[model samples]
Target: MKLKKLVLTGAAGRLGSYLREPLSKLCDELVSTDINDVGNLYEGETFIKADLANFDDMMGVIEGAEMVVHMGAIVDEAPFEELLGPNFVGSYNVWEAAHKHGVRRVIYGSSIHAVGMYPKNEFINTEVAHRPDTFYGLAKCFTEDLGRMYWEKRGLESVHMRILSAAQVNNPRALGSWLSYDDLIQLVTRCIDTPVTGFAVIYGVSNNDRAPVDNAKAAFLGYRPKDNAEDFAADVLAEADVLDPHDPGHMCHGGPFASVELGNSGLAGMNVIDDRKKS
Candidate 1:
């Protein structure tokens, strides 16, 4: 079943870039929006430069859409004030606009930081309580609750993908947390195509043998990840730093995010590559 219209926020971002073409194929018209220019457009895609924090902008972009792939947000830790606009209020605008417009579902690009303080060995599941590790993580938790409220109160559907690490596998921690681009695409596609998801949460880690999270509760979504970070484990582990039993960065689910200061950058130590797909 194809959607008549689909709205994708953050179309200019790294992960968003990879999704534009594929998402365009899922709907008759893909309305791609971002604060920055989305450059060249795909065959069935249209670009709209809009801010997620603006209620009017969100309403305008989401109008006449069946579903929303909300990928726009600051991916790193920053001051609460700085993140307030794009990360916190922006999420509200999206959900509120979707509700007002009667959109079918919202597939949010949430992060592991929302539950980042948990020990890595725990193998947490979607049912675990929130334990935000930074302002960015707190923003995720807020939006998740917001989604839940909208679903229970207003009948708006939402799927929150708690992405662990959607970057290259360069370290030992990534061996268990890495979410490959292919698996990321598959997960989003599954979220959009699912028949019914009143309000759900699912880990975004791939099918790695050493994955730190469980997705059994989310089996209803049919998101069977195809890739694994273990493929890069040998090389990553060969150059891995010695284990630090007490360091949150090494022992927590959020990796660098769990160790970073509240308002500092978590990506600084993550060595994430710039692999955004070109238009």
Candidate 2:
């Protein structure tokens, strides 16, 4: 059944922009909210300026929605104070508001950094305990547990997608961790349309031959990703010189995030392009 109303947080963000058009087509009304204005929306989409950390504002944005696509948060490592409002408290507000408003489900854009400290050589699954490499990753761990508690207690459903990486494949890490935009949309769609997903945690990765994480436990969600980083492997590997295997940034599942000091910038050493379309 098509959703009557769907609310998407972080509407002005990179991934959020990619989701706007596709999600707008899946519902009668698509309410997109963010801290900044997302000008000139699609046909069925409407934008709302809201703050994620403010409980009342989050409540207002999510009220009456059947499901919420929560993509709002600080997407990198930072001081606890900087992340406190947007990444930590913001998540709390989103979940609490969803509970109060009786939203059926929340499709969270979680990150693999939640368990990022694990070695790249070790293949882990959703059931693995979190080994966060930074405060940003810690926030993901907190929210995943939050979702589980809510589902077990309040009957609200949620899907925590532990995304390895979502970017244009350009580097060696991306060759194993990249999740194409098309695959991301399909993953979100499967999470939304699945009949009975009870607080499930799924890895948001394509079928990369060198993928470090396992998604076998989440098979019930029916998310069969169609993209593979191997498509770009030749170019990426050719341009990439030998990496220091001793470096956690190259040897850990978190990539650059694993090597950075706490409260440091994870994007500092990596090369990723911003591909969000201009509105």
Candidate 3:
């Protein structure tokens, strides 16, 4: 089940850093790339500095790779003009280069913000129409369609992992949306090892009692998450703020993203911890 080469974009990022060690073991050579250098490397891993917005850079990084984990991007919401190169063009470059190089599949880090406008009470599935909360979410929607088109038109495979909350479970919303790091690794592993996923979409969420999204349609991928944010519910809820019933930030699936102004930072209000994995 090992690949000859696996490319991981955003290797210097928080989630990417956590993945480097595991992904390195999944392949003979793990080619990790990012705009900045990853300070250290794991066994069977090598780092390459590359910008996602540049097609030539992406092509060179992806060449000879069996699978690509496309995680590089300006993670927070920003002006469409500012995000145009990194988020929009970057995804296009990855898909196009993977297509040109005959790569097997792309496992993308899609987000819940892609359908952030949906009410938190209403459980949505992968097939729901896009209701992006920000330009960042819009970019996710765009890449998802891009992945679908690539699979249908060129026979390239893709797995769009609509990650909910891959952060610390510090708030009430996270009790339903959290995707723990261990679960994140498992989700990506399933995407890579699944035998024949032509074009699939899966919600990257843990087995929480209050999970807001359904992954039944993507059962073929065999991603069964283990952690539950409910473990942190007692402490988090004891110090929780009273809910504003009228606020979309509390009522919508996007959480803070659903209420943030366009081009504003959604992470700013989230109080997400800086927990990037160290080499």
Candidate 4:
């Protein structure tokens, strides 16, 4: 079923860039919104400059859309004041606007950091309580709860995808939590196409042999991840020898996000592989 219109926030972001083309194929019109202008677009794709923090701006972008893919925000752990606008308030605006416009569903890019405080040794499912390790993670938790409330009150459906790792596999942690680009597209497509998801949380991970999270509850969504991290496991393990178990970053599911101090950069020692496509 092709959608009448689909709104994708954070269109200029790395993941969002990849989503535009694919999502455009699934809808009559794909309206991509970001703080900055995203020049040159795919067929049936349009760009909208909007501020995530402003409720009116968010409403403007989402109006006349059947579904929304919310990916806009401060993508890291920052000071409370800094996060309030983009991460916290921006999220509120998205939900509020979606509700007002009568959108059917919101496919949110949630993070594993929402439950980052949990030890890596313990494998948890979607039902596990949130133990956010940072303010960024806290924001995700708030949105998840908000999604639930909206579903209960109004008839809005939301699927909070607790993404483990969506970057190129470069470290041992990713060997267990990696989500490849192809798999990500499939996951989002399933989230959007699924007919009756009423406020649900699902882990976004590939079919990694050593994956630490479970997605059994979200079987109805039919997200069968094809990629596996084991392909790069040997290289990652060879490079990441003698890890410090005492470090929370090494011990927790959140990886570097759990170890970083509050209001500090989580990208400190993360040698992330930026594989964002360059046109």
TM-score, every prediction = 0.99, 0.98, 0.99, 0.98
lDDT of model number 3: 0.94
After superposition, which runs of candidate 2 have C-alpha atoms over 4 Å from their true positions? none
The candidate 1 region of ten consecutive residues with least summed lDDT is 212-221
Choose the strongest candidate by lDDT. Answer: 3
Better structure of 3 and 4 per TM-score: 3
**Candidate with better lDDT, 3 vs 4:** 3
Candidate 3 C-alpha lDDT tens digits along 1-279: 999999999899899988999999999999999988888788899999999999999999999999999999999999999999999999999999999999999999999999999999898999999999999999999999999999999999999999999999999999999999999999999999998999988899999999999889768988888899989999999999899989999999999999999999999889799899889
Give the C-alpha miss distance for residue 21 in model 4, angstroms. Answer: 0.6
Question: Candidate 2 clash total?
Answer: 0
Candidate 1 to truth, TM: 0.99
Q: Model 3 off-target regions past 4 Å? A: none
Error of 4 at 134 (Å): 0.8
| Candidate 3 least-lDDT 10 residues | 217-226
Please report the TM-score between candidate 3 and the true structure: 0.99
Candidate 2 lDDT over 1-279, as tens digits, reads 799999999889889989999999899999999998888889888888999999999999898999999999988899999999988899889999999999999999999999999999999988899999899999999999999999999999999999888988989999889888999899999888998898999999998999998899668878888888999989999999899999999999999999999999897778878898565
Superposed model 4: Cα runs more than 4 Å off: none
Count clashing residue pairs per candidate.
0, 0, 0, 0
Which candidate do you rate higher for lDDT, 2 or 4?
Answer: 2
lDDT of 4 by residue, 72-103 (tens): 88888899899999889998899999999999
